[model samples]
Target: MSCDGDQHTMQSSDDVLPPPGDIQVLLLTLDSVSLSWSSPQGLIGPQTFRVTWGCDGETSSTRVKDVHHLKISSLKPGEKYQFNVATEGEDGRQSRWVSASLSTVLPAPDQLTVDSVDTTSAAVSWNQSPGLDHTQHHYQISYRCSGTEPHITTTSSPSITLCDLKPATEYSVTVCTVLENGKQSQLVLTTFTTVLPAPDQLTVDSVDTTSAAVSWSQPPGLNQTQHHYHYQISYQCPGTKPHITTTSSHSISLSDLQCGTQYSVTVCTVLENGKQSQLVSTTLTTGSCPEGWRRFGCSCYYLSTEEKSWEESRQDCLERGADLVIINSEEEQTFINGFEPDSYAWIGLTDSVTEGTWKWVDGTPLTTPRYWWSGEPGGGTYQNCGEIYYISSGQGVWRDYDCTFSQQWICEK
Candidate 1:
């Protein structure tokens, strides 16, 4: 039994086949790149293909049946990857592996966030994309209002702060990362709105005994979108305790104030988002009683601790833009009774003009009967001035006394 030459030659040829060739990368994406190639020649049916790919000391492999194009995934961006492909026949025959090189697209950044934002500036930060390790990457940023040219800037770090933006304006910001090879990833985008500015020209317009009127001008050079805002007015008689009010009008009245008291007032802009602007302040003094005087009913009063003659006390009141106190009713008399039990104070009542006739210093006579202590005016000409039992008395009635007598006094205006 002798084997023929053709039979032996065909048996040797069936044992092995040629590998795939001329592998070409057709397209590249963020994570995976597509590849196409010429199929292996002289291969029979039921054949399998082997493909192995690697980048930067990492490798992965895949097997498929009779496919001309193979896709290698899990490849790094901005890097060179080496790929090898071979053909396998059902007869347990394998061809030599063919090698080629391809590169993937650069990866985009991850987790872009605005760390902080304000009226004139914003701070931004981002994380490096996957497979971007050990590569010197910087950020290129652009921002602009709608339908306008974008402003471009670059930084060597992943975070940046942008300044000098218009207040109360909306802007679109885009950030892209660039590798050392000048390849840029896909752009990431976000929207930003600057905060509103403070109210302008805050001023005190008028003041009264119990309140003051304040006015402010709306912020100038603002567009229609920014022009709408309400005002928050805050005031403090003392700087430590603050009271607030909100008003839509440009002018507002602050009430419930003590007379002759100074206050610091501030106005802030409240936006649609319930955000407030910086505080603008002014100082105002209400017009009423002087510093030490307290207002009661129609007049302001001041009590003296220094004892003086009735004439001296009355003269001091005149110089203080006031006059000596004149009691006309039971309530007025009761108010003056707040003085100490051991105290006595001079009033405007005096019979100085005409002896034995009681009169107020302003020429108003004591027209009412029983407007005196029981059996008062008994001093006649000697006791011309009048005084009151100012404190802790069963009756705070008047007692006629000599004008030259020195005592504490009350003044009014």
Candidate 2:
């Protein structure tokens, strides 16, 4: 071939009409289309094929690339479309377009099943897209409460579970097929919502000091989630406001309650949806201590006071169903001494008759002395008896004074 001056002489190669070979396009699957053609023997180089595809008469074209085949994707499922491929040559010459008309694919029947739904959520499961090539393309799933765009897509298995939805909500979900080319198929809506867990168990256990323990269990049901228990204890004293404790635990310790008092207790369970269970209630009793005294060591005794000498104080205690505050050890002696300060009283120990000797009325020999205040047991001519004196309220000191001197005293029973 030679080029002439203006529109040069170019040799015409019009004699190459190979037998018309079958060039057919078939819809192989939802995500894939096949284009097969017979290769004519005499071709100088690889052929460039362009495919035009679209739905509802809307057409789009792919640029020419050096390949005998081209695939069209992102078509709607159960939708129909037509496509044509054309060949081009080195000098920009083109071959006649080979066209084929076919429907993209039929959508698979959705696997619709109802799952448990709670006050705020529902759970749904469905079958995967059948038309998508298990190898080349993945799926994108979208859902909406109504007809709208921008659905949610997930690559997870055949099922998806949603959360944080409105209580008693109805949601519509659809899955679209996406290709590596970023094209997406039509939406396949799935109907599903999360289900709420069942009511939990409510329990209360009694504790000392007007206290009680409470606990609960998770609700029972499919897709149970975000379960918790809410608890409170309420009690009323005759003339006092009700005491309340809000906690998530099954038990709490209450203290400083009036003896012989009664209290009420209650418990409830809570769900992630903010729905709470029915509260259960029970009663408890606070036992009693004797009058004008407190309970300790399972016994009640009057914490009374008397003013008498060591012998007289002992006789006074014996007359009043009690005993002179016995000082078995320094601890008891110091305890009584500390009961009152700044006032002198009589305790059970005295060595009035014999110097350097001490004894309780009960004939117990005094081995230890607590708070032998300032030169105690001076063995001088004046001091003889063990005197209990108070330096302050609830604080006391001891001294050695004449046994007959009148002093205040403490009594216990």
Candidate 3:
């Protein structure tokens, strides 16, 4: 609005100072207002511009010696205020006050909502801020992972989609309302938690009759968030109770299962929140074992390292839930020969009951097609025990020895 620079009320002084003109208010905000006015025309030298303002029934004045404009601050937001400006000439003459009225900025956005949270992204929305202007209205969005610095963005649509989040994560979000007048409302704050991801890509690395090794990877979006991960592995035979195993590593070897049996295996990832991800399952067959015995081919063998007499060795093998070695085929004879090279080991053959009638330890009689050396059993009834002789020939051959001789033996279970 225009104020008269030369126009003034009647004054008796010879040097009459002109009144300030063209008073205007610009750059108003929630807390402060700026005021500018032209200098009075009649002033001869530098003039002191006086700015006086009053609001809520209290008045305060400030004087600047040479500047035509004064910026007033520290006013309450969303409050009404009145301001007045005047010019005091260098001669001590003062002009009447030119006044302007203003109302401060609007209140902050309300009802902040953070929703649709997942491993890597979330959605944010809010209500419009309460204020006098909406022409340039917008919401300033600021969000950060819990315990970290924040990032900011501006949007006029009142809603935003957050990105680059992590699984099982917490975030703090703030929304502020701004109007065309550049006045921002108080910030609205809230927190949100992202959902845990589902573990996938389960693999059974290897499997044996009684044990299996399984491996898996954590679900997507959980790499940075899950500093400590847990794996839950469950396996079961068709009719048995499930065996559960827990470990921090992604790979686990499960044991104590039935051999040659099909088993169902599942792996799940455990989040820091103690929530388990979706289960990934696979099937494998475990290898077989015979109590403490190891199997090869169609039979299981338990080699004994202790030295004992022929009879004592026989009894010891039987006590250990097995039988002494019995050569039934040429291949079997050759295998036994290589098993104990450069040494003699007792076999389950003897003619203890009858001098010329050979018999297996299991009561089977030796027939004419035999695996024996021509000169064996020369001691007649006294050489009644049979042993594998390996030192005298290129390949081992069976020979009858005294039953009192001590040697190492092999047991078949």
TM-score of each: 0.49, 0.30, 0.44
lDDT (CA) per prediction: 0.76, 0.55, 0.73
Clash totals for all models, in order? Answer: 0, 36, 4
The C-alpha RMSD in Å for every predicted model, in order, reads 11.9, 17.0, 14.9
1-413 in candidate 2: lDDT tens per residue? Answer: 11111221222334233311345775466655776665544665566544556555456766445555555555655455666555545565545565667766654325744465555555566566575433355656665664445447566465555655643335776665565556565666656544433335545444333233444454443232423445445666667788776665545566656545676655554554565545566666655433555433322234445455666766777886566565555545546655553367766667765777876656677775466667766776656677666666443566788767666665564
List clashing residue pairs in candidate 1.
Answer: none
User: 1-413, model 1: which lDDT tens digit per residue?
Assistant: 11111111111223267877777888787557788778666655666766667665656666677668866565556777777767766765667777788677787777888887777788888887766675678888999886678899998777889888877778888888787778787899888787777878988887656777899887654544645678898898874588988988889989888667789999988877787788899998776656777777746789987888999999999997678898776777777766542467898888888887788889978886334667876876679998886535444777899889888899977
Output the TM-score of candidate 2. 0.30
Error of 1 at 191 (Å): 1.6
Global local distance difference test of model 3: 0.73
- Candidate 1 differs from the real structure by a C-alpha RMSD in angstroms, to one decimal, of 11.9
